[model samples]
Target chain A: LGPVMIVDTPGMDDEGELGLLRIEKCKEVMAKVDIAILVVDGTLGMSDGDRMLKKMFEERNLPYITVYNKLDLVQQRIGKGRTREVPQDSIWVSASDKINITDLKDMVAHLVVDPSNGRKIIADLISEGDIVVLVTPIDEAAPKGRLILPQQQTLRDILDTGAIGVVTQVPQIPEVLASLAKTPALVVTDSQAFKEVNELVPEDILLTSFSMLFARYKGDLGEAILSANYLDKLEDGAKILISEGCTHHRQCNDIGTVKLPKMIEKTTGKNFHFEWSSGDSFPDDLSTFDLVVHCGGCMLNPREMMHRIRICQNAGVPITNYGVIMAKMQGILPRVSAPLLGKK
Target chain B: LGPVMIVDTPGMDDEGELGLLRIEKCKEVMAKVDIAILVVDGTLGMSDGDRMLKKMFEERNLPYITVYNKLDLVQQRIGKGRTREVPQDSIWVSASDKINITDLKDMVAHLVVDPSNGRKIIADLISEGDIVVLVTPIDEAAPKGRLILPQQQTLRDILDTGAIGVVTQVPQIPEVLASLAKTPALVVTDSQAFKEVNELVPEDILLTSFSMLFARYKGDLGEAILSANYLDKLEDGAKILISEGCTHHRQCNDIGTVKLPKMIEKTTGKNFHFEWSSGDSFPDDLSTFDLVVHCGGCMLNPREMMHRIRICQNAGVPITNYGVIMAKMQGILPRVSAPLLGKK
Candidate 1:
């Protein structure tokens, strides 16, 4: 959401066993953050650890701004004691008095947010007057009396872009298309009904799955596309790890733990080992696994999903979501990815 | 050795609950076998399960022959009662009497052993009287007594192919090359010394690592190469799974659990999540991992390693051994792979 994600991390140079672990954890956080704010105690001045961290940031070419905290205390001792030296590019702030806190927020905003970057989701795909169709399948898996996040987000994206959205289930997709005066600018469907929707949509109209769009949005589309090809080379006793964003739904559990595994085994003609994970706490250890199959991640924010993807990429693991994997299995991946392919 | 490995499996289609698990185990064994022998009790005749087992083998297109057991009992009943119907493709054999067992052995030998497959490890790389240099590092990780299995096997392969093998440690590689009488046909090095050995070996000489060759001999080389690229893209907080073949060595523990992770983190400038596994029991649930780094697997047979590789490939996970990863990290992977690349 427009670069508003802020992560508050612990001090990097803590002492003792747990402190050492915290320092390691700080380094991990340091690697993932775009910009870091080093909070320093003004009275104590800068320690060697602070200098080391600043150098670490400089080595990665990661920009960092220092914050001098406890400005109130510094001010209280102004007449009696010497003022501590602050870095040239740093800001002075006090948590107790909220001194220069607004300036800190403004500085962060200036550094991170770029209005010209064009961060809109589907806005680039369609113009103000264009009609966009969304095919949502209402099945046992569908939540009671509510649309899932991805569908809602897609609808909102269309609305925000000033485009008209025609929402319907899989069976009504053909009728909905016929009833419209002009062909929709794009058709996005739930991945489960991708094959059916692909057939119903005309050749000229752009089509893609919701999962694929999310994958592109979340920064793992290339990896998902690349990993889809691996399904063909599976041999006996191959392992496939299936994960989902939400764990409680019976339908997702069935698909992840049972149906998908069965389909993969049958398609490859190989008996495979299957592992399952769900919800937000993704496994940290992934060395034993060969492949990771994730869900559409409707409930997960793009940042979380991207982190998961980045983790996989770093580990040299290939990862794909249910939509892409199923699309590949059904021979409709090329069609679903056509719209994005053109832009690339 | 010469089709000498024999796997004794339990009977399929056994009766009780425990027997059912054994039966499943039998089917797994059957899946890996080149040929199946159905030992039938001559007097009892073929049961429904036996027919089912035969059908299963037929479905897999696995070649099979039937063996009629208790030939002595059949002989005793010859003049007393109606004779059982024996299949045309069956042989009468008695373990106690040792009847027609030699024919069964010959049949197995005829089906499995073929001399023309060129099973030699590096025979294709060298001609008779050619010299090959091996660079082994006798570091802390090296065994106290002798060379590892891959090195020993490579030596044997060279001898079998009428090629001369010149062995040396990392420091002695340059001297060994200078002293050689002729240009060596190939140079192989322990994966740990890949970078150093790569620089010392002449550009014209063929070169490869023990792990890379083992990767090809055991299973998929393409997968390993593709997975190696993933090392370049790892981010901070990425998960890396490191595994070893055997468990007892303190040296491997330090490298796997300590040194390699440190090297990777330092090189990538990103803190990573790490997982470790050792010995014969690999983790079944590999879905949570992003990458798997394995050992050269001297303790593991080619078949087992191949199965592990296939498992990784099928799951769409990228895998590399310690050597390939280190070589790539050290910028020596291309030089080491040059010889194999030429063949390709």
Candidate 2:
């Protein structure tokens, strides 16, 4: 299966207190998994437990595959004649003998629709042989050896599209552009150095940040832009929730905790009560907060990022990401977002 | 912290049988963690339990940082005069007040040496503007929308080195070569299509598979090559262990369980007793097995892959990977391995 997680749960048919707890756990797991594998005993045929599980799956609109195990015993007892009564989509397998296991796997794999259906991080923005310069500052917070995941992925996407990628630090951007045979098609920089890079790169060249590119690629760009602009309307005592997708240690210059908060307060010139959240636990109730400023969400899938946006939409709260907010604060939101918004 | 895993252990001073089990569990966790943080109550100072934990860490050559928390309480009691006795590396902090937390994080990050250390997947092999044709066969096992990780990573590496990457399917290899302005520096393909690719690609062009490139990048290529040769020497009933780095469901045409086993039996004309292992569990005692065939280990880090190789070396059992073995059985081992062996 492609990017599928198969969780094995306890049998639904059980009695007593412990059994009920196990059943509750199974139901909880059912909400997380995309599909279900209902294993039945071929010798005994369909039971009430199987019927109940099937009904639950149907009610939830969860696609599933029914598998009748112990095919060896079934063959030994009924000589393959009774198997005709089994459902059309059901597969008969012997766990020990490895019979029809491949068929069962194929069924599971077929159920998965491609999630990354022709989505590109930046490849779609440029053509083959087009020069795309990336400005990455080697700051104290930068990883020791290689570039960060967003930069690496952007470079890879550009390469996949047959576009030329030129990487340089903030200081070398002017020289890199001067030395190029022709003016580069686009320039991308780290969000933290966006102000300096915006000043360095010429007005003719389209420019954006890694975070901005990912915001458009992974989530709703139009909504994020609207939320970024909403920063100006916040009062002095507004409640802001700062969220990150991954839970790494707080670095000395952590963007979510330190830089972004300082910048937001400075831009609005207002004191705001800030709350921090990281990792998988996003608060379901967003109504308590006046605004939610989230990370670029490189670690999260598009579905999750969209879900967070939808949650904010449902709660009537403004939600923006780190890159979009930084661009907004730097007074170049339109210039930085123009390339991604199809205004270039 | 750079790639650090911090585990909060239960206090070691608990009483009775449950306390002893908790202490044992802490010891087990200590073995897995790279460094330890011994948090001590600032008021109570060092206790016997703390000393015992320190001794255990020292015995295991595990580096540790001792933090005396509740700086406010310590200041109230001693007014910072008694802090001279604390180690130079240790810091006083108040978790609630968020004091000196950044210094503590900086200390942990300093402890980690850069792991990558300028390692390149294929960048070192090619120069700027060097054309590299990649032969990718779109098959049933291929992911729906995007290329697999290895291919994506290799293409990124080539781009990072300023090389031009031309991607084509197996049938288009000839046409891609014909249309190229110059002969490509290297031609890489999926290992499953090696036989056809070998015939289609010119002898002068450096050729290899994604799996073969990863074998060298992540593990010792010489060891893998030797182990692959040992496959021919196996007796009919020799015990062989087939291992995969990831534990995904077996696809109908899975390379590990289906293709490799079939090829191995056909080439060697032997019916060996095969055992399968996947994910993190590697058998400690490999002396019983005559040979171990492993996957390319793209899912695992370089350290873990090398550790597995060392385990095989210690047990005096030959170990090889899927790509190397497949090359050997196809009688193109020398041709494929040469590209990565520095012979080209």
Candidate 3:
């Protein structure tokens, strides 16, 4: 019972429309669980319905333990040791007297297995005491009173690695660089300010963006880079889906809805059909679209993000994010992603 | 005006406590914007407050356009063609008469820049018509009525890539493999079933788990693998944070709260202080913990997920997820992650 979900499903032997519906619901619930517990009335032993349930669990490869409840009644009726046969893994318990419940709980806990992995932001890229410069341009779209999640996280990662992080704005990059004792180990800028920061930061120092770092950290960097090339292949009337992970209030000049579409059209010099999707609902079928351009997924979990990428992959459609596309369009994709990608 | 957010803040010249607080709020608003529109009264021309606001914009590198409103009043008072000098980008308009608004909107749109990149699931791994076997063990935790997001996504990705995905349960995996015309290009199982699936799948064929693929797709697989080794380094009384991205109803036998903690304790043979965090609130200060074990982050966006990783990295704490840890604990990490990592 510890950390385990106990679903009290409807009787498997129920009949008629409502009963059938209940059984159907039970089946649906059955599809998702890791372990099953079949509680049987000990006096009656296993019924046909219980057998069907057991078979269902077996077919699904579900590990289960049978619980024979009302053990006192069974014991009294069968004279103790003469009780009916049961599965080896089955346990006998008296619900009223609380018999063998602890044993049942232990068995259940043992069957509940863990399935999981881990990650890092930029901690691996630099050494202790290394100076890391971050160019965060405060604009109308910047969050009020604090840095956005990505910036705060990047700086924290630097601190975690025992490294120095020099935070500055776009216009102050040159001054920040000039004031440094030695060339910083890495210069990470907001994707929107990459072009300006690229010119200001020395050619020898490694440079990247919050978006680019996230592209690799939370998603597939290599696939995003490859998909960026799809921009060139876009033909007239090509279909594109512009997807944003979170549905924040639309600003007058929202990047995903306005600027990105405009940029895509202007860059390709081709007319195309543009579609937009926001929040948790991504279309199941992505095959209709020639390309999918997504925002840096700050709001979505890794599994959802990867699922999206998988959807695009299955559809045979190329997908890129706002940062990678902007870098590619600005002709700095390679230069900005170099530090993270471990390439020149 | 299209998709742009217009925040009307208190006067920049405001003084005193409440007034200063209003101005502080205004400054907070200014930090997040892409562009600024300074509306000056034509009758008043440019006041000292206006100059200060413009200077703030310039210092922050915010592109702005000034509008001289009540042009009719200014022209009537000062005579036509005798207006006060203004910046080159300033526009003269009569607000009541709806003058030059289109041009102002265009200017604002021109200032909004797109900053973004992009991903894939298993579509990148399997080819068209390739048979990919999926071993999903249905248990009590399975969601009612439909497949979980990850499974649905993987299946969809298979269809998208023009590949054949044979979905089966763990007990039926042997039959599934036996029935196949030839060896499947890959066999992906739930991480919980990795041990059994690892034994069943042939060494000649590629094998991995959905969690392993996602670890790479949505996060750093190498980092996860490295962090998994940290399990061996855990000492008695070491603090561990078991973080989950979403806060679903805790089942009687919840994996994160019950199974995982118990498993860690059993595997390490050490007593540890375990803490928990779920949903959007990850502790900003994670330095107190020796290690952080996180869920796969299906509910969190990539940015937030990566941010948590960054936080852990910054805290100098080793972090691993449910899938990777399970594989590691079961001694099947190498076998389960091989196909995705491109090594055996």
Candidate 4:
């Protein structure tokens, strides 16, 4: 259940005007995968494109399985009992005929590295039936009538581990804590409300933010913390980039555009030039920016977030997510980073 | 495979501050369904809320199957194999115990109104191995490197029906047709290129647009075509509403904002006031508009589109889709509507 998920790519050798773009896409996909599966046509055997794909996997030290499909056609040509020679450790199957598909599934399952070997949200810290309080602030920036993806995903993870998630807003935390029959195991809050919630929750209880958990899950949390340390070094008129993963109409009190910028200006006490990019458009050339502050990346896939992180790393720019930045600005970076470091 | 898809709704008796909105959502869902399944707790029997839900379903003349869950608890209370009174035609089972779940599935399959019994895309006209030509225009509005949803769904339908789909751009349609060993059974194009495609496709070969076919499949084609007839009745300075199911930055040559308006002005030679709405903000009150021209609605679900159509119908306003209007303006509405009507 804790196995890594697979990323599907397009047909590699679509030899036309856009073939190069498709190949470029494949290379990007290759950067994020730990293993690869090469599907080949049984009738046509392996082509040059397949060989190049295999080489790419091998160059990256990715263990891969070669799957020969359309076994029905081969069976029809040479009769059912006849077996043709295939690559060693390759799987031959017919999707339509239901031939050896289960074996292929088992092989894929066996190849997955344990995805939970690294940091986890709460499974290692708490056990079944433990109570975890989640503090979500209902503000102008919140989507109407629904919780955002990060909170929903974190709650789902806790449920999966058989833990009870007690949801409350920032204002109700004091009342919720008083009403609870037993002391809660941990308190997680939206980073925007960190200052107030940090003050409300007792120092004895474990506390964190959704963004901090996700940063460690899908991105480099240690690096994010290290980069956030650069916030105090910014000079007046230093260029900063603010990137959001999703684009929606900016509300009156939108956290990304309004609240975060205000916090940064207040903390640094220096006016800086700010550039903004949202939805899929991340600047490849990060050389111009003193710092890059990205969203918590709930809308983005793990691979895409990782790719963006690597791009920032390669560009030698200090990159930190919204939550990490806010936590650092609140002077709670060491306190929050303590819980995650133990799990790591 | 013929099972009726489950519609997961909020807890019916959510009697709290937002209960009115929840009830409104339920009524909207009820309008689109033929039958309802009321699941209740076995131990609790029928509550007032359950009775209300049943009455609502009955008022709409919807057949319902009452499913009493947690039968295991009831059995433990009353002793196993002892009969207890239940409503006629009611099912009692435990979900956690995996009891009578198959019976529930069979009931759902039996209740399905055979969704495909009414409208189909292209499967009715073409047989196995028949060739169909698809003309797509790669323009600025096109998503970076993939076919739009309608085109992808149509191509998939063709493949599912065992028909061959030949894909080409607007410029290559001529070469593709000439190079084909056998004449294609049909030619379909993007509605934006209907003028040129209608001219290029032979008179003998059946021709249609993606939007036209989708209107019939996902929406009301007959009503759409009928509403298109109302375009001639518009006067100078008449109010018209243009609604798109999704929003994007309108490119210089985008169909919805630029091309459609241009076509309307040229065809009618009467300037009209235009009101635009995009992305799920359909007006409930349409009395101000003379006509409503909507997108093909590939992004919208069938229920949502039908709800919008019903709103327009209730307002006594003529509502039509983009493809139907364009075909009518081009004087090809009769030709395109012919193929769909035979099946209708």
Candidate 5:
């Protein structure tokens, strides 16, 4: 259990091949999760896909709850029985109606390592009143009126951590840190801005990306960071697949298109070939790829990312996402993720 | 050859379950029809799916010219003997760029029934100067800026048949027909407006919906009509899936949401049950369902629709779409589709 819980879920019915890619993702999330919640549209009765997932849970021996989302669309907690294969404890929850939410909280709470047991990485990190600073860049793709779901979620989780989370814009981060009375417990920066943020943050402060937690949560932190190190080895003319879970025009600063390639070349001193695909177009035949670097997957579920991660692993191709690689390159990989390992 | 062209198609990559249904549909189309054109997306490059369709053509000895689409999106065609698998004489086309359209015309003209032959269906039905009255009801689901694709296509086919097609709104159909010389050669209508239009067309005059052409073009008239009759047998509380190809709401008559179920029950003389889903959701499991009703598939490619059709057929479930069933109920089946079929 860490102070942050990053999710990587894709939508049910996407435009193209991306929709199917999301299915691979669900499996990834289940494989690494200590506690898993399978969510369904509340208004729509449980679908066959949901049933299929619960059976997967039974096979994997992962504990799970069936969360009925968008309760605001429908009020009833329409229930169904667990498959003969799964545990009888399958639950129904609604995030929009706030119905059965307490049940979800209790399920997650139970998954948390006991306080006396001192098993949670997140729980251990909080020295009551510790101020953790979150650095977020306000890019145009960050929705027109509000923060993206992941950022809002991070804010809520910070509140749950019982620590003062001083949210600061990336530019204000330096001033915010200098004015603080105490050395901050942590500084989490976006993967796109990590290189600069790492230079400014002191050696003692923990730094990581939301993507890093997801890599750990989905069970591949060590391998992903190692794969990311390949950024240093990208030879000129090497093909790089910069994949994103969602779509956006003008992805500010060209993180996938321009910056990552520059960083790869700067760090490894290798000229690299780059092509970008956003929203569900990772080719199945990946034998031709030299390296694949992905986003933090704020829009995707852990299950899908892990599937892609596994794809690379199965193909003998190196695959890594933004944050884990950034953290590893900066030399704070363990200090950032070790907090969430829960004795394992 | 009349305007009709029955086609057999291949399956989608992940839609393995749809194979049997598509094969059945292909067989149904093969059993009828005067001509067939196998359309292929050229820019994307033909793969196994196209190969499978080619095998079907070979097995049936059906004469077909590959209408390669989206030529505008590709670089120069690699030229003859490149793939070795594809026909050397295949015509390149671009629906988007309107390139090589005459090649398609020449191909269809050569491969299809001899249009000059007195044995052709359209020639036998309407002389060069004959008038054809078309009934099309415009509604919200009707594309705001243009005519629906099928109706526009049917009108073009009618023109190519050398008959003057007088188009009219459904309510204005009676007035327009009254003013025409004698009875019009044919009467075509939107199936949703079948009831009112059926009453207006004389018993001897030809009448059909835009959907009927799709049914015959895809080659499954009898089975489609028969499967749709399953709606009559559904229990009051029975589950029926009314699926559509697109995500947008029906613009007029609230057809899928309100009208179709009512007509199903009205014709069944019983309170038949109905449920609806639009956009990529075609149920995989059908053991719980009594029947499946699909739309005419204005938005889906043959590859995807045939997959859904196959799922129902393989599961031993009856399946039919809007136009075929409406044609049967209105008793105008043979006449509307006569344009596509030549004498044996």
Candidate 6:
């Protein structure tokens, strides 16, 4: 049994058309996606990308729901005489406020999935008491007092599965596994730390990242993570483009710049030339690059992200995002994502 | 001899692909533009659009100076860990910050028209005795106790012209002209008040709006205003999309909503299905409509706006923005846009 999730991406900003890439990646996975969650800013209402993604889902017949995020910013808009809007097939929920999260999950209960894809909804994925270990790093970008939205959502999803969830960091994972009498059913680590977790964990232990699950849930796991294979084919000094969605609190030691480059160098053991572009500086032509590594794109629209992926494909460049690449590099490419990407 | 001016546009969230559009449009008017005033937001560093515009200027071999606007917002960004960024060929001045207006004009003293266009720099176009009447409508959208940025810029442009700027409302323009001994050289009305002002101005006077000047400044004046000719040919029930560039100060009885619609209806004198979309909502298929009425698109990148225009062109739908449409409707299209758009 496994869990299904969705990732709503932001606009083309935060990396020139990075959202477009994610949208293309999402479409690749949409065929098997169990639940499509569209996240939008309540203050801005539905953006061009939001409406475009919804149209994409309608065309694809994806079972999707919408979450109006950032309701805390509502008072300001309301003070200005603007009303909060929930467009069709959507519910308002502030990711920070944790409002209506229960309703959100409950709606997922009646949600339909692609029968051929055999995506086991969380209800069918796990029985009570299955062990789920969340491996997250306490990095500078990690908020001071609390975990970020995606981490919190994953923990909640794990709890909803009735799975016994244990949270640990990459360094603590080997010790945590030593003490566990039974191997955990699943280990979801921060994508940034997935490589090390994979090295220490046994081959049988389930390993994945929130992003990997997101890729599978959104129906892009294979096409997205497969870009990691590009590492082998890349020419020496080849240009690589990496992009992320959010700009706020973008740390100086960003994974897009520091860790991912190190990982690629370690995985291929080659000093591959890299060009790091973030927030909305996505280059127009992706053809020049050997491969493109992208972030989760939580803040971007799914359509724009997909458009970017299609651009890479059209340009004949291999493209993958953080989590999918992490899962592949971490060596749990299958068991971690098989439940969702696998054919029935 | 009126004050002829050029305007630099702002980027639409995604809609203002004006940078790319202008590049293509510039190909037609590269030799025609009298001055190129490159614009950059004072708060948001040199954006991709800005870079693209700069590249276009370089490629076209156009003489351009930069205008860094929104100085008031610059300080706000400083506190938010953001600092002022100035690209070359640009001067940093807050259009909002008083007393720097003269400095902007002084910088413009260096403008050199592309020799091919044969258009003279605006500063040389003005005569000492010409009375330049500016029709400024203080609408709800107008900031409290202050004129809009465009108005303020126009006033400065008038002073630089050495033409006496006779400021008045549309209703008072006739009286002001009568009071003056000589026929005014030009009458620049707010695009929203073009119809009323058009009738009051004599044939010898130049008539235009800021939007018209912007169209010329962006090097697409003729093409944009030409789209308005198709208004009469539009099907009765044919869809018409009206889109604005940004989401700023949507005043009650906004010009986009109230005046543009009323004026268009009065000019066409026929009912047509109308759909109003603002901000970055323009989809790729503008061909579904008989005509697309767009705003000045000051807030969008030229590439994005051109994308819409190209879409409509490909779809066989005529597209015109606010000022262009207004001029055409008044039957004084060429005259209103003439000084800047050329003696059409």
- Each model's TM-score, in the order given? 0.45, 0.57, 0.39, 0.48, 0.36, 0.35
Q: On residues A186-228, what C-alpha lDDT tens digit does candidate 1 reach at each position?
A: 8888887877887888888889988888777765787898887
Clashes of 3: 57
**What CA RMSD would you report for each candidate?**
34.0, 9.4, 22.4, 31.3, 22.8, 27.3
Top candidate, metric lDDT: 2
Q: Indicate the residue-level lDDT of B135 in model 6.
A: 72
Question: Which candidate has the highest DockQ of all?
Answer: 2
If both were scored by DockQ, which would come out higher, candidate 2 or candidate 5? 2
Clashing pairs in 4: none
lDDT of each: 0.72, 0.78, 0.74, 0.77, 0.62, 0.63
Kindly list the per-residue Cα lDDT of model 3 for residues A97-119, writing each as its tens digit. 78788988888877764311145
Residue B99: error of model 2 in Å?
7.6
**lDDT preference between candidates 2 and 3, better one:** 2
Candidate 3: TM-score? Answer: 0.39
Question: What's the ranking of the predictions by TM-score, best on top?
Answer: 2, 4, 1, 3, 5, 6
Candidate 6's clash total is 58
* Per-residue lDDT of candidate 2, residues A99-136 (tens digit): 88998889887765543344677878888667678776
Any residue pairs clashing in model 1, and if so which?
A286-B289, A287-B241, A289-B286, A290-B317, A291-B315, A314-B234, A315-B291
lDDT of 6 by residue, A1-344 (tens): 12334444435233456766876666655643555787777777777777777888899767788878776678555654344655566777767767677877777766743332544323244555565666766654654324455555454444444444455556656655655566667777777766687787787776667786655543355678578766677776888888765566465237788878888789877787888766555666877788888787664445446656777788988878887776666666665676445432
Off by over 4 Å in 6: A1-125, A178-181, A249-253, A265-273, A280-284, A301-304, A326-344, B1-344
Mind giving the per-residue lDDT tens digits that candidate 6 earns over B165-192?
A: 4455555455455555556566677787
Q: Write candidate 3's Cα lDDT for B208-313 as tens digits.
A: 8777776766666787888888889888999999888788745312888898899889988899999998875678799899888888876554444666787788
- Candidate 3, position B54, lDDT: 90
lDDT of 1 at A120: 46
A-chain TM-score per prediction?
Answer: 0.82, 0.80, 0.69, 0.83, 0.61, 0.59
True contacts kept of 6: 0.00
lDDT of 2 by residue, B1-344 (tens): 33444679998887799889988888756644556889988888888888899999899777788888888777777775344367886778889777789988887776544333345678777887676777766565655435666776676676556565566667656655655446778888888889999999988888988878887787778888999999989999999999987786354228778778888999999898888888767777899999999998766666568778888999999999988898899998998888777633
Worst window of 10 by summed lDDT in candidate 5 chain B: B114-123
